[model samples]
Target: MSSTHAVNKTIQEINEKIKKGTAVVLNAEEMIDVVRKKGKVQAAKDVDVVTTGTFSPMCSSGVLFNIGQTMPPTIKTSHVWLNGVPCYGGLAAVDSYLGATEPAEDDPLNKVYPGQFKYGGSHVIEDLVRGKVVHLRATAYGTDCYPRRELSRDITLADLPEALLLNPRNCYQNYNCAVNLTSRLIYTYMGPLKPNAKNANYATAGQISPLFNDPYLKTIGLGTKIFIGGAQGYVLGAGTQHVANPERNERGIPLSGAGTLMLKGDLKKMDERYLRGVSVVGYGTSLCVGVGIPIPILNEEMAWFTGVSDEDIDMPVKDYGYDYPNRLPRILKHAKFSELVSGEIELDGKKVPTVPLTSYTRSLEIANELKKWISEGSFTLTEAQEEIPSN
Candidate 1:
């Protein structure tokens, strides 16, 4: 906890400013311009909070809710399904979790690799948030206290009082741009990859992503309030497969996938637009969740970090055609996010078309929304109860 610059602020001080309607907040994109003009030291003194955001396909997202108890309170559900998709029913008799990637039990290609998965948990989540009709079914072993063995009903999200989004991993700090080196086309979570490295796809909002703004996770940790799915949410802890230290440049910019965040929020308060379900032609179902975090300019160093531009970020290009599936340790190359967003990049002396699984447009929208919330004193930053681990 040391500072490299001669400026400092605190979360408490920022919250006081929020209460007094005096906090100077900016989104990550705007912070770059401020840094360019005023420099980090001046920017640190001028800006109180910098907000970052992302809207991306997160396979680890899901919701946990307690369906209303059956009549006579006798249904001890042992299995559960929503709109033909299976849900984890082991939590409690009436509590269950629906994973974003769980294919519908009735999906024709549910078990086939590289199959067209039309619907799954993400769709179910969207339906719940949209207030659409959803069918609920369950089966249980009858007992003295729980006499019901089977149950079925049509329900909506409003029927559940404790529907909490418990995403296990999300908002990747950085990510690989996937390409196919093989002669034939391939389908992956990154999307379709044309044969022979003709196309590339990536995910992340680059400089605007939450963890990217706080590269070291110094200010983000347990209980940190965040903007998630258009609702107020909290950081639960480190995400699965989190990497504290990855390859970085001289400026400490990570050139590969690094840290991740686990988030939790009440789904009932979420906006439907920020939580859409998606299905890939050959891949499976996934949730496109919006996430935003406000990073306080605790020091000049923090301000400098928040000013990271797309040009400063580099990400690895990997071969999903072979290396990825084989778990081979190889990087095809590295490309700047600036170049990646330009819709194309050169690899192996060839121009390859590029796309992003994460929506930069939605990301900016989410960031601006958070900025507005802070400006209106409707949101304030929180000090982490515990710091996120690096390793």
Candidate 2:
């Protein structure tokens, strides 16, 4: 490495440059070209931060809120339901969580044939974020210290003391490309899959995705600032099902839903555009959350990792109709993102069309927006308070 290319830096040094408005920030797409043209060493010397983004329906996401004290100002809330959707009321007081995947209590869960299943916790959350009124109904076993038993009221997010976007597991580092091998169609969280390998579906922004840019999570960890739901958020920790060990390819990238993140942000500041409710046919309801993470180019290695391209990332394909539902998520074949983006993948020697569940266009917007904030000295990367577990 030449003197011009071989330069080592830190998050603090990058922060100083960001503060001075002299930092050269780039999105993951641009970083790919920079690394290709100038090489990793030169790219590391040139770029300070690389921004990445992903917008997809993640089921392991939800909103946590405190509807404030009811009339008597005392209610040991035991069971809470929002807009006919059952909420997790295990928390103290009027606090409850609306899980994105939780169905309504009286929901016609696929029992009514020839009808699309819709309306759930996710939709209720979207309504709140959009400033629409949400009906709140609760019941509790009367206690001495907190006596009130039953409470019912229509409340908006504005009525709450705090509404938080608290996601347990999100941004699965890698995921499956689902297809059906059986003779009939199958609807899954990945969306509707055509039978006989006619169509396949995947969800990821590829190279520009957050975890893809920092595969090893070298700089992304606890307390790392991020662009989430069109607002600033922090990484809480390694998300649920997150484990350090996983199967990796030659490039050291995981082959499954390996690396994950727990994230939190102020729901009050979130934009409805980035936080949306979606219902998959026969699958369930889910929240589409837009998330972006900026990686400080601390060294040549960081530059190289951020330059990961679609062609280089491979995710395994699974038969959602046959293998997936039977507890055997067998990898029929591994397909490249480049191929998936091309709208087709050759599965079982058949040319199957591919569909993406996430929006790359929205992802680009988020990355660009974050870049703009950083370049304008409005955003600075945070040094992780704790490391994300990785091997």
**TM per model?**
0.96, 0.96
Q: Which sections of candidate 2 miss by over 4 Å?
A: 1-5, 70-72, 108-111, 114-116
Model 2 RMSD vs true structure: 1.7
Error of 2 at 325 (Å): 1.8
Model 1 whole-model lDDT (C-alpha atoms): 0.90
RMSD of each: 2.6, 1.7
Candidate 2: the clashing residue pairs are none
Cα error of candidate 1 at position 178, Å: 0.3
lDDT of 1 by residue, 357-377 (tens): 999999999999999999999
Per-model CA lDDT versus the true structure: 0.90, 0.90
